[model samples]
Target chain A: MNLWRLPRLRAGALAVWRRNILVWRKLFVPALLMNFGEPVLYLLGLGFGLGHFVGDMSGMPYLAFLASGIIASSAMTTASFEGMYSVFTRMVPQKTYEAILATPLEVDDILAGEMLWCATKSLFSGIAILAVATLLGVVAGWQALWVLPVVFLIGLCFAGPAMIMSSLASNYDFFNYYFVLVITPMFILCGVFYPISTLPAVAQGAVQLLPLTHAVMLTRSLVAGAELTQPVLHITVLAVYAAISYYIAVILVRRKLLV
Target chain B: MWFPPDWPGLSHSNFNRHAITFYNAGSMDTVENEVMAADAPTIRARGLCKQFADRKAVDGIDFDVYPGKCFGFVGPNGAGKTTTLRMAMGLTPLSGGTLTVFGQSIADHASAVRRRVGIVPQADNLDPDFSVEENLYIYASFFALPRAQVEARIDALLAFMSLGDRRRAKTTTLSGGMQRRLTIARALINAPELIVLDEPTTGLDPQARHVIWGRLNELKSRGKTLLLTTHYMEEAERLCDELIIMDHGRILAQGPPRELIERHVEPEVIEVRGEEGAALQELVASSGCRQERMDTSLYCYSRDAAPLIESLKGLHGLKFVHRPTGLEDVFLRLTGRELRDQ
Candidate 1:
């Protein structure tokens, strides 16, 4: 019942994380397609097809502009889907968490394991897109290696809040409302496809409040070799959102399942 | 409750606790547990309570479970049996009062406590993705057990549960009985001192139930403590050394199954079915014996059924059955014959 009380976590959380890795390895083929295929399509189909007529965006070629945006967008969806759909299946119908709870692991350990696994999948999507975009000769530098750690942070940034949504969901259909209402809208508005400056003043202000806005600003800055307006501020905001949402999500899930 | 045809001397008072055929004091896995059984209680609860929005599931009950004894919680469905077990395992937080395991508070030392204990939950929650042996390996990994040691234990446990042939089979492909046996094997993977099972054989066929019962008795004979809940009076009568009959989140009675039956019911009972006869009913009521009436059956209990039978001798179409009273008669008498949670 204590909102601020930190759950006593242990290193055993990694056991749960390892379990997921084994399952992912078992289903390697489809998982690889899902993680890598869609973003590649969006990049090549939209980047080359749409980049043909349109020339440059923000002093960069249209293909280069969309590449970093695709990394941020794809990372967001991959992490969010893991936190929502996969986590929901394990938590509810599969009853996996309940089995874990019977052992030495606490509910906190299970949630931490789920969050780490979600972030890992997100990191996979981000790295795959970045690799393809580099081979296309659209963007490359030693500076892009720094994008790996930042993309991992971006995965973590979206994971906690997406799990909060997962803790709220009752079934798979509930995630549609989340994607349509929250995720897809954030995808379009967070400067992923173009600059946020083109939007109306109030809409731009509202977009600034979204988590993906900060995520895209950080990864895109590192990917496109552009100077960020305030790098520390964006990173801090994402980290704070991740922390606060994570705390609230733990409490909410405890209420939902442990009652 | 099944007795083999060869063991005619096995009575309720001296079943298998002494001179067990399969298990003996010399063969106990750990001698430390045999000594620990003398002093400290394995589980203790005081003024325990669990409250929902408007009702309490476990309403302020006190009990103690000593080591080397099979204690039972017997109640109808929705009588808070599972809730109480969940609290002990630290899966659910107690709304009020104190519960301790192995002399440590469950709330404060849950992980340390759970590390030594094993749980067989009410439902089958085996991982569908893993093989039988893989399931055992994955579960053992939680305890951080050494791989080499666990590999040997898994092989022995598979054979113990008669799952050796199904080591590589998917959990989903096993029959219900095999799945139940696998779950029991999984629970014993760590060789825990205390095992808590909730309705272990609820949905199984009679043969599966008998198999699990035999395994549980073997564990008990080896001096592993057991705490279980069941609506089957026969299960409680056979497995538990002491049991409590619970209803509506409260215990109605607690003692050895034989002692509880004796305390709550007469030793012999006569049942009369068919025919509505005010004359026969009045004769039995005036004869000073206990009586319970259902739709068409009227049960009369006394030290002797001869007088009651002699009085109702000529009642037309009325059938009579005389037999020794058992734990089911006491359970029905204490809890009453009514559909709970309706």
Candidate 2:
């Protein structure tokens, strides 16, 4: 009934962010290894093994084309997982949100802090993937560094939806549906492994509606040092998803935490 | 609305307004010295209620908690004690009526009121991933206390709670009692004016319970206002300056513990057990005393027990013990002896 209740950003958010950082600092080693290790295996297994036959796509080697897409997609997966699994654990099993709410921090503070933390985590994973791809000669010129900030924005975009899911989740089992129905479809159809242009016209049109498609397209242009046309349009699409999802996520989290 | 003047991030003018208002409201010296004169109530609720669907979790209830006094809410499970506490702490919204903390409405100024209060929840929801010190540090950050200021109190608080040796251990590694103590310690990190505790010693052993009670008494003696809920009648009698007995989301009686017992039940009680109770009860039927029967025991209440004991001499097979009536007798008399559970 009170859908027009406006949400404001406050200072207590940093406290929640600091709490997560303190805990994450203790477990960063294994976390970093997974973030870096997974993309490396995918790049080797799919890019090299599958690229032998595909050769080149649109005047670039298949491995190079695939590497940029992985950078964008990896950030998506990392942020989504952090927002869903980790946020759920903190909210439900651990009761971290309950403890924080007892203090001066409001529901809005916890929501903003959680989203920022997930985005920060996504940035970490994306950077590691980029470094590995560069060492393997899949990256183009220094212009590829521009992909870092774009990867962070992709993380924020996915984190918003994943957090909305966390707010509605009753148990961990519900997350499997999200992965199978939402994440898997995007991973396959958003041009991560191959160009979506090869799919049917209807499928390609549907792919453009997905947030991952814009992330992949923008990252590919930046990583390949290609002069991109309508670059603002691509960035705006990702930014719009991030902003709208963030607004909805905040509303959902407020309802869940403040009864 | 009253945010603590020292908490970080408040605008300079807002801090000045809070300081001047609270000074006029007489909450500025909340914990520093004994309040010799009459003080204003730290919390007030008038017709406060909370509804979930068709059920009333906390039906219209009223109470006042004065500064430097300990107020206790004693009730059985599902009696709306926790719901009322949650509302007072701004963890949940009020369904109807007015509730205020430090003279400011909770519904209108929850965030500001929350900044000036502390809470120890019934459950030990400490961060299991952090060490004891880290738990304290993270909680202090919620109040926006400077790292240096929080650091200054860490050692003192840990030692005061007898958690000094376990400061470096993960919270999950601590025993149940230790974790509860740590939770209490965490609540005091902000030096709050009003501390709300929900069943602070519900599951502790006798020794641990006494230790926590001793610490709570110390906090009270230092002039900190305390509002707590407990199922233990003895705890309410020993610690509360004033207490309320609640049932079915309503207040049954409200007054000092001793006064309530004195006003509700007789001065003395004789509990008789075994099959001979009915026989003994018949003999005292003409003694002008009152009796109530439980499943296996008969409780006799009288102003004088000497004549009652004399009347029971011939009924030699029954076991009986006489003692002064306590808050438990008053509570049972007010709320009835029925089990209150879903």
Name the best candidate (by lDDT): 2
lDDT of 2 by residue, A89-207 (tens): 99888989989988988777887888788888878887887888898897888988888888888988898899889988999989999999999999989998888889999998998
DockQ computed for model 2 against the true two-chain complex using alpha carbons: 0.64
Clashing pairs in 1: none
Model 1: how far is A147 from its true place, Å?
Answer: 2.2
How badly does each model clash, as a count of residue pairs? 0, 0
lDDT of 2 at A257: 71
User: Residue-wise lDDT of candidate 1 within A1-259, one digit each (tens)?
Assistant: 3434676567777888888888798899998888778878888899999999888888888888899888888878887888888888888899887778778887777777777787788888888888888988777576877877777677777778777887888888888888999999999999999899999999999999988888888877788877777989888887787677767777877777776
Give interface RMSD, every candidate, in order.
1.4, 2.0
lDDT per residue (tens digit) for residues B251-324 in model 1: 88887898888889999998887756688878888878998987788889998878887877766666789899
Tally clashing residue pairs in candidate 1.
Answer: 0
Residue-level lDDT of model 2, residues B107-222, one tens digit each, is 77888887888899999999989999999999999999988989988988999999999989999899889999999999999988899999999999999999999999999998
Docking category for candidate 2?
medium
The 0-to-1 C-alpha lDDT of every candidate, in the order given, reads: 0.83, 0.85
Off by over 4 Å in 2: A1-4, B1-38, B276-278
Lowest-scoring 10 consecutive residues by lDDT in candidate 1 chain A? A1-10
